[model samples]
Target: MLRIHFTDADLARTRIASAPDPLWEICASLHRMQSRQGRWAYADWYRGTRARLHDTGMVRTLRTLLLPLVPRAAYFPDFLTPPEAVDGLEAGVEAVLATGKERVRAEIGILHRTSGAPAWAPRLADPELRQDLVHALRRYHALAIAPHHDRVQARIDAERAARARAVLDGGTEALLAGLGPDLRWQHPVLHTRYPEDRDLYLNGRGLLLVPSYFCWGNPVTFGDTELDPVLIYSLRHEPHPSALPGDLGSGAPLAALLGRTRAAVLRTAATGATTGEIARAVGVSASSASQHAGALREAGLLVSRRHAAFVLHTLTPLGAALLRANAPCAEPR
Candidate 1:
């Protein structure tokens, strides 16, 4: 059992990640590859990833190097999963490379003690070795994750949207209490059924709740309590079989009501596109795309924020909900 003690300050500071953490997904998927646990939810993904790795000629290298780093037990190196990875893959890799040599050595030593580290694991302290690891991670993601990125993103977005609604309907306590079956929220203490017994006092640093599409079974936290506090938990639902990229406009009634152009614009925003990019993607005039985006924003389906001179558009909770409700029955090609 893992007991997490929280304070009023910690409760106020608690928040959910806006998107999936690439590193956590990578680690979780690697663990899935090692065992048949949660096979019911991930059998298709597992088979597909294995075939992809074999076709891309990455099976042997990954098996020898990366697999050892992410064993199916306690003490995988924390440096491999940086807290800053919520931004994206490149940022996450940069964080991995920027890990202090001493920290890297210490984390590697822990892995060695808990689950024997590969001989080459010690060399991670070297900058070149770190870069190689990053390269391997990127390659694996490209081959294994990129193809299903949209499906994963859609599932995560839906879960976060529901959680957000919970917050609005019942405040922080409701949000915490509804986290999942594995977690039990009781006043200031959040109990989790962990592999081992442990306790974490928030100390007002708060916690970041990250939703992962691949993380299986119980929720996971950093082994080293001193690290930034986070709980990466599995999504409540598996990726819907029909949830595919670019299928947002397939809903006949929605497309008819909004027209193909505007509906396409809303779907494009689901993946976070700028106005100009949306224009190019939907083959519309920049001014026309901007107008459509404005209308969607007004309808509470899209939210646009200015980043420098460009206005980036992303789906709101209502928007994501609408998209999921209208997703096509057939998978994308």
Candidate 2:
């Protein structure tokens, strides 16, 4: 088990990352490719990713470089998933490049001791070698991650909306408590499943809760406490979720009944999704999603309200009943 001790200030400061962290996703996605655990959840992504990697001739780079460095194990170097990744991939690669040589050596040494590293792993401290690794990461992301970014963003956006609701309905504690079945919030300490026993003290810096599309089974944190305290945990995935009604082909009867994207917009709003969330989830432009939502609101299928800069949409009774009649039985948890 891993325990995260938080102060009041930590609670005040604690928040979810507004956007996906690319480097962390890279690490998680690598683990997904390496392990069969929870493979069913990522069946589509797995198939697509494998084909992309093969077509791009990234097989050697993935095997000889990426997998060895980011083995699906208890420990991998923290520098690979730097906090700067929250900004974007390029910023993250820059952070990885900027890692101090001493820190890189120390982290690589830890990786080797905890979960065997390649013989060349120690040489990561060399700036030139780090550039090579960065290249591999970028290539892997392009092949595996960038293509599926919309789905990833939609899933993460849904999770963020749910968490945001939890915070508004209760407080920050509610957000933590409802993180997932794998995590438990016991007042000042948040406990999560881990391969080892450890404690993280977030004296006041708080914690960055990163909901990852690829992280599976457990929450991951930095090996070094001195780093920014962020917890990367698996986001719940429902195959063909209501939020992603667009996955059903455009010619499907449901699309014909409600006009494809409009129907997706409605389903996404079932959980009070924002206009932006609806746009991403249904693979439509924000203007399109807004127009669909406006039409639905006028038709009495959705209720919309302005909250801060976001307009939140929730399903009306008629809309819920319509969905219930058309929706399949809920997926088993």
Candidate 3:
């Protein structure tokens, strides 16, 4: 009944920016996981695991798997928790299988009620199944944190109650409007599961929020991982290249510094190429490349060091990451 207009693809782009390599890797890994597990079974296991764990943060990990399926019109309320976290890989499968069975009964009850039938009939018919599911969930909780179950449950209960109060008072709306001036609202929330910060549940908006740490977790995973080509179509492509600071800025000198030749020299240097190689690559003379490279070194995009007769150029960590993201993948493997 929710009037949600956004799709999974939209969720990926806004949350998973084109620049971060780790974001791309997470998406690719999830694509493989879903293909092996089958979709419905995975979803059922995910929800039951979260309910048992009683920690919503576990749900945030799911974005790693769900990234590739962003375009699909499916709703996975809590497929964020991986099986390994709940009960190890083997136990997680068993848990999912049991939860899938209970889910069938729950779905039937909801359907019957939606048809204007007596909800009691469905509940009565599935009483035993419901009881068994509760027992299984309790078992999950036991395996989850049996040693600290009392303390953990108390915390989860408190947080759950607080979340309920926030929903009742429209806390979501206030959080979105930058209610607190010092909330670091500009920090840009990445894929996360903090109750009030989940925009999907709040306003049914396509925008996603995640912690920055999650975005930059694993960079090389993108190159080795396979992704669906369909994501290319899902992206909102720009018709023309965006202007650089020099082109878009008000001052003429600043715009001139951001010129194409200068930018290309910096970009090549960012990739660890020498000035001579950069000039050859960019179709400029070596001396011309040297001039631009020096400018970029001054601007902090390139670090130049004299090695023998050659000046070695390499990007700072920040420069390398930025360049890698904007550059095209060498070939679709």
Candidate 4:
């Protein structure tokens, strides 16, 4: 069991990540590759990734180097997933390279003690070895993760929006309580079903709630405990049926009713897209996209809100239900 003690200050400071943290996804996806624990949920992705790696001849290098560092166990080097990576992959890789030699050595030593990593693993702190690891990570991401990036982002967006609605409906406690089946929220404490018994006192530093598409089973926090507090939890697996080819074609009745451009805009809004993003996705001029979006909004299919200068468009409940009804056969069982 893992107990997280919180305070009023901590509650005030706690918040969810607006986007997927690339490094967390990388670490979690690597774990997924090594284990068949949740294979049923990710069967398509697993098969696709394996085939891609084999075709590109990256299977050997990734298994030997990267796999060792990201073993499916309690202790992997924390340096591989710095908090700064919330911004992007480049920021995360750069942070890994910029880690001080002493800190790198100390983290590797901890991994060795906990997981019995080989004696030579400590040499990863050296510049040449570190660069090689970065190269390997980039290659792995390109081969295994990049192809599914849109789907991954879509899942994250759906989860975040759901959580936000929970908060609005029942406040912060409800949001925390509904994190997952493994987590229980009891006022000032959040109890988690962890493999090891542990306690994490928030100490008013608060917690960062990160939703990961690939993180399986239980929520995970930093092993060291001294790092900025973060709870990386698995997002619920919701089938995105709109991604299917025939689901939104002009031949479909809904698409024909809405016209192909408006239907495409509505589909994109299911996972939340901005005006410009919707335009680029549907390959329409910005002005044309705006007109379609406005029509959808007038028709109660999309709700648009101003975030800074851009209008973020998301599907209304009516819109999502319509899409799902039209794509019933596309959903995973």
Candidate 5:
């Protein structure tokens, strides 16, 4: 069990990541490829990414370079996922490149000790070798992570909406309490099932809750305590093939959402709304609002998630784009 001890100051400082971290998603998706644990949830992505890698002849790079470094294990270098990743992938890769050679060597050594690393792992300290690693990371991300950006962002947005509602209704503590079944919040300590036994003392720095689309099984945190505190966790999987990002033009056309109620439903979900909230905003009954939301969701325009006592609805990337074309005015009713 991993126990994260928090303080009063920690509660005041705790917050959710405003957006998904690309580097963490890269790491998590690599783990997904290594294990079949949650394969059913990502079956489409799994098959597609594999085929893309093979077609691009990046299969050797994934097997030889990427997997060794990011093995679905208890430890991988924390430097690979820096705080700079919050900015974007380029910034994160630059951070990885700029990591001190000595520190890189040390972390690689740790990886060898914890989980067997490649024989050449320590050579990553060489700047030339590091560049090769960075290049492969970029290629893998393009083939795997980039194509699914919309679905990943949609899932993260849904999670943010749910957590934001929790924070407003209860408090930061409530936000922590509802971080999926993998996490347990009991007073000042948050517990989780982990590969190893350990405890993390927040010590007033608080924690950043990063919702990752690919993270599976148990929640993950940096093995190094010196870095800023963060918990990268997976969201509840809802396999909506129509909603999953990929394939060209698999969705209904925007003209299909020309109906007044469905367009209103899409617009109201711009900032996320419950069924009742959507109904009230669009001047319709709850069941009517639900049916419209369902229609929009099927049209790949809205993503809904259940939080506490309500099902919150938010716009998917496709949904948002279509709403701009169909409902130029912000006011729903």
Candidate 6:
């Protein structure tokens, strides 16, 4: 059984206090942006935001790749060109967020109806309005991120075709020789499925909460939290056969220092830290350690302040919990 643990308010509070960066801030800001922009370009915002949040890396990389595709005149801030060019994009994003909310309610409504719980009644009312909101968000993401997306899609398609060609060449011949008549192309041995709806909830980092009240439990009190195991395992798992360039398992002393450096930052818990101490404790050059600290700071996990020539960093509560959760476990309790 997959037992999902519920994070209580205290935990949330702790996370906020120790948070090292601005992830939530980004979410809140994005939500607010959608809300305000929804009044104008609803459609573009819906799709654009979704694209940006879901396939963030692709979206980001696309900016560079798509530069040629984008007209020289179209180069401007916020993915799309000027405001007049991206009409209804923002409103579309708002609608998608609304739609997502409705999906959650519908899922919860079904659970509630099945559970025969009276507390679920409040959530059932006007479920469509919320659902509409989520739909708006999806629409917004699609449109808002479209300018760069075309380039990304082309790049991905090209890469995929190249890989397929390589496999079909020498690779297929060797496989066919070994498998004889056992090989069957009709049944695909390799496949990939990207869950659009599920990815809608996760902000790439792989975490989101569905309100419990909408589900079988009290909508107000019983939401469920989902964590993507793939991302979690990738971020915090045993050593692998081949380590990444600067990954923790890479045997790079600088990479190893990050964990301890992060730990010291978290213990400070919003009080912040000095760059020199962070460097010394982490066993890295002050400049290199500062670079690491800057990343966490940028990621919204840590906040920094300038004291004379030195910068001090402190973990936000969220950063603390993340560090603790990612920390090496002692023993099975």
Ranking by lDDT: 5, 2, 1, 4, 3, 6
Candidate 4 lDDT over residue span 197-307, tens digit each? 999999999999999878998888888889999999997664432232123444343443357778789888887777898999999988988889987765556666653
Which candidate achieves the best lDDT against the true structure? 5
Supply candidate 3's per-residue lDDT for 281.
81
Per-residue lDDT tens digits for candidate 1, residues 91-158, read 99999999999998988999999889988888899989999899999999998788777667766765
TM-score of each: 0.75, 0.79, 0.23, 0.76, 0.94, 0.23
Per residue, candidate 3 scores C-alpha lDDT tens digits across 73-134 of 12211212222223333344333334443554554444343333233323423446445433
Please list all clashing residue pairs in model 2, or write none if there are none: none
Best by TM-score: 5
- Model 3 residue runs over 4 Å out of place are 1-257, 328-333
* lDDT agreement of model 2 with the native: 0.84
- For candidate 5, write residues 1-333 as lDDT tens digits: 999999999999998898889889989999998898888889889998999999999999999998999998889999899999899999999999999999998999999999988999898899899899889989988999999887788778888889989999999999999999999999989999999999999999999999998999899999998789999988898754453543327445545677777877787899899999999999999998998888777676788888878999998887776656655566768
- Residue 296, candidate 4: C-alpha displacement in angstroms: 14
Those runs of model 1 whose alpha carbons end farther than 4 Å from true positions after fitting are: 238-333
TM-score of 3: 0.23
TM-score: model 4 vs. ground truth: 0.76
- Overlapping backbone residue pairs in candidate 6 total 92
Give me the runs in candidate 2 sitting further than 4 Å from their true place: 239-250, 254-333
Between candidates 3 and 6, the one scoring higher on lDDT is 3
Q: Per-prediction RMSD in angstroms?
A: 10.7, 10.2, 20.6, 10.2, 3.0, 23.0
Better of 4 and 5 by lDDT: 5
> Model 2 TM-score?
0.79
lDDT of 1: 0.83
lDDT of 2 at 59: 96
What TM-score, to 2 decimals, does candidate 5 have?
0.94
Ranked candidates, highest TM-score first? 5, 2, 4, 1, 3, 6
